[model samples]
Target: MLSRLRDRPWTTALLIACVAQLLFLWGLGRPGKLSFDEVHYVPAARTLLALAYPANTEHPLVAKAFIAAGIALFGDTPWGWRIFGTLAGTATVLGVFACLQLLFRRTPVSAFGAGLAMLNQTLLIEARTAMLEVYLGAFTTLAIAALLWSMRGRPALRLTLSAVLFGLAVGVKWAAIPYVAGAGLLLIWGKSDQRDYWPGLSLFPALALFGLVSVGTYLATFAPAFFYAQDPLTLSRLIPFQVEMYQRQTQILAPHPYQSSWWSWPLLIRPIWYFYEPDNGVQRGVLLLGNPAIMWGGLVAVAACLWAGWRRRSRALLGVGLLWVGSLAVWAVIPKSLGFYYYYHLSSIWLCLALAAAFHAYAKGRFARANEWFALPVLMLFVYFYPIISAAPLSGPQAFNRWMWLDSWR
Candidate 1:
């Protein structure tokens, strides 16, 4: 099985992603209640479906609309509320595969990156719940792939498609705007006759068209949210609505139990728990945590990429790191009180890619077995933490405590 899979790395990576999604879906509806953001987004979805303005105007509707679509098909069960998230999670994994393929052109390394994406506990946790971040993450990751594809010869179509996805990603979460920034940098670098990969597309016109299409796609996403109300009128009301949203976001200065500063995020100092049913009989909970081996290992790997990229003058390393840095850095500018652990998703996405690069580079060095050995501990961490991450019933407080590495986790 291993030999056969080694010959077809993309197929293997996709299978792993699918298996993870299937596992997420198999017992997905358990605990049977809305978890964290689900409590907010699911009702908002119902509102959209009913032709009423949703309560949380702070967030855009693209992701909620998806949850609404899921609910429409699945009939308002827990499965209904969270089903799209599973699909989004699967999409994120595929995005990682496509991206690695473009960047490294190595099927095994790309496959390993996809595996790293699946291994991130927070990514999996967000997938099992109804949250905007998963959709944002998935769409942005795919848009990154599209942008890379656009770097090839006569890539106007791919660039346009990438713009559309980036626009959709923005509509999912305003946070995804950073992806557009990353794309812009990539497009700018891909300019001219000294092309490394493909015969470059017309530079200026293509960039202008890319912006136009991106804006068009973004506005199109908001189009559906407006039709239900005619008297208040959608387009005219949008500016005021966004102004109000910005006001609300800024006013989130009060402390939150689960909130953490952006600085604490990369260190894995705090994690958020989205749901819990800690009854006297059985204690079940879902914690938004990472596989420590991968999370910490990723940090080291990314740092190594810093040195390696600088030494090799590696464009891929620098570009991938830029996404991670910019995403996380922007959060520092946002209200510190409003920041939380889940915001780490953006950085984590790129970190997975960097980790794969590390594994690839390490394997090529004298310590050829290092990367494989590293996977052993990562796999062990995933299995050991599965119960808590999935809300499976625990043995007792002791069992729960065993998983709790710090006070903030409580």
Candidate 2:
């Protein structure tokens, strides 16, 4: 089975996606109620189903529309509210696998990275809940994968697909705009032999084509919003609506207990408790935390990539490092005064890639066995912390203390 997987990359990718979907589906409706941000998106989706005025006006409609579609298909139960999120989460895992395969061309390394991403608590938690971040993360990751594929073959078609995916990501949240810009920049300056990669087009024209397609796709996501019976949005109202959204995002708010600076996210300094309650004589909780093995180990891998990429001129290493840094850097300059650790969700995917790249690079050295077995520790950490992160019943209220290893975690 291992040899077969290493031989067939697509099969490995599909298998990983299936396992991730099953993992996300298991106990998805636990606690039998909305958790954390589900309180916001689930309700907005319900309102969207009624075709009334938009509820979550500060953001775009793609993600809420997906939730609405899920409810429409599944009848608004806990399963209905969260079903699409599970699928989006699976898509995210597949995206990570695709990116790794394209970058490394090694199925074992790709599978390892995808597995690490799935087990890393944040993806699992977000996947089982109805929220915008999971959807945004899925689209952005897939967009990057598509951009990488363009470099291999069918440049025009693949680049168009990437543009559409990135636009869909932006429609989920404005935060995705940087990734779209990054994709354009990649085409303009990524390769010196532009004639081979982008045939029939020069530098500026290639960028112009990508930009036009992405903006058009972004506008199309607002189609549902335009038809809202009450206070329907129109072309004339679009720009003003963007200004309102920007203002809402930037406005200062009272400090949140779980809010942490962008710098602290890589260190896992704080995690937001998505749910905590006593029910049926047991304590249940869901904490938005990353797997410690992956979080800390990934930092070392990222530093290695930065050093090796610069010295070796490896596009794969440079790309992974840039994507990881770019995802987190946006938070530093964005006007949003308050941030949560969950915001690091996108960067976590790149962290997995960097780790996989490091492992693949060392696959033939004395540490080959150690590198191959790294997934064991990552998986073990997930299993050890699964109870708290998945809302499983705990021994008592103080059960969380066992997992809270750092003073800042509390």
Candidate 2 regions exceeding 4 Å error are 191-196
lDDT tens readout by residue for model 1, 1-410: 87788778677776878786886686787667787888888898988877675467787789999999998999898888889999899899889988888888878788778887888877888888888988999999988888888776458888888999999998887787766876776666667436543354566777797889987888788777666652333787876877776677677477778888888988888888787776435777888888888778888888777777778888777666666677788887765347888989878878889888877665675777677788888889988899888888887656778887888788
State every prediction's TM-score relative to the real structure.
0.94, 0.97
Q: How many backbone clashes does candidate 1 have?
A: 0
- Most lDDT-accurate candidate: 2
* Pairs with backbone N, CA or C atoms under 3 Å apart (clashes), candidate 1: none
TM-score of candidate 1 on Cα atoms, chains taken together: 0.94
**Cα lDDT for residue 267, candidate 1:** 83
